[model samples]
Target: MPDVKFKHVVSCSSEDPKNPAANLVAQEAFRKWKGVAGQPSVSVILQLEKSTKVRALDIGNEFSAFIEVLVGKSTDTEDAYH
Candidate 1:
């Protein structure tokens, strides 16, 4: 049997620059991803970026905060989708 595994990493950062709600939104977005997969072996990394003038956060600064969701699937799953 093929040991199929799926993983996804998601990151969120606010575009408002000063809006604290962006951090909250990122957290909620990460939490929401928990339901994306029902398999026990599936793994995910949720990252948040809160930038300050003194200490810059890795999260990017652009117009309209965005949540990036990347989905990874194992080759073993190729048969399942078909």
Candidate 2:
């Protein structure tokens, strides 16, 4: 099996651009999600216009996340039999 790839996108904002607490808040939030296994290509989107509260949007629906997993070999498996 090929190495699987995953993408995690998080959206958050800061009340004050100069406030040092903002970084801590975001960092903690990211840490929580990072603990999950098989998670690669993590990304974060910051919206300075919005409040400090973190908001997440599920890629598919209310019960699901936007994370995508792709697994497959780069080479052709069909030739294995030959």
Candidate 3:
């Protein structure tokens, strides 16, 4: 959402140089985040600036077959995504 602000990218598997992961949060529709070829799968972890409850998500990915959203706290373990 426009209210949410991302601090930085914690980690990312792949991303296009022209269209980086930061485009995902950008308001411009022309700019988009695209992964490189030859990869089995891709993943990106975007860290938020603050702890805020997300009631909903707006996913608009037509290129990928599927996408999974994982939410976790700074103190929670990897398995805590549920």
Q: Show the lowest summed lDDT stretch of 10 residues, model 2.
A: 1-10
Regions more than 4 Å wrong, model 3 = 25-31
Residues 1-82 of candidate 2 have per-residue lDDT tens digits of 3222222222422223343323423533332223223443343342232223324433322223565432232243632321
Scanning candidate 1 in windows of ten residues, the lowest lDDT window is 31-40
> Could you give me the TM-score of model 1 versus the true structure?
0.19
Error of 2 at 76 (Å): 41
Q: Which digits, one per residue and each the tens of the lDDT, describe model 1 over residues 1-82?
A: 3212212234322223344332333523432222222332322343223321223223442332344434332433432322
Collision pairs in model 3: none
Per-model TM-score versus the true fold = 0.19, 0.19, 0.75
The Cα local distance difference test for each model comes to 0.31, 0.32, 0.77
Better of 1 and 2 by lDDT: 2
Query: How close to the true structure is residue 19 of candidate 1, measured as C-alpha lDDT?
Result: 42
Candidate 3: lDDT over CA atoms?
A: 0.77
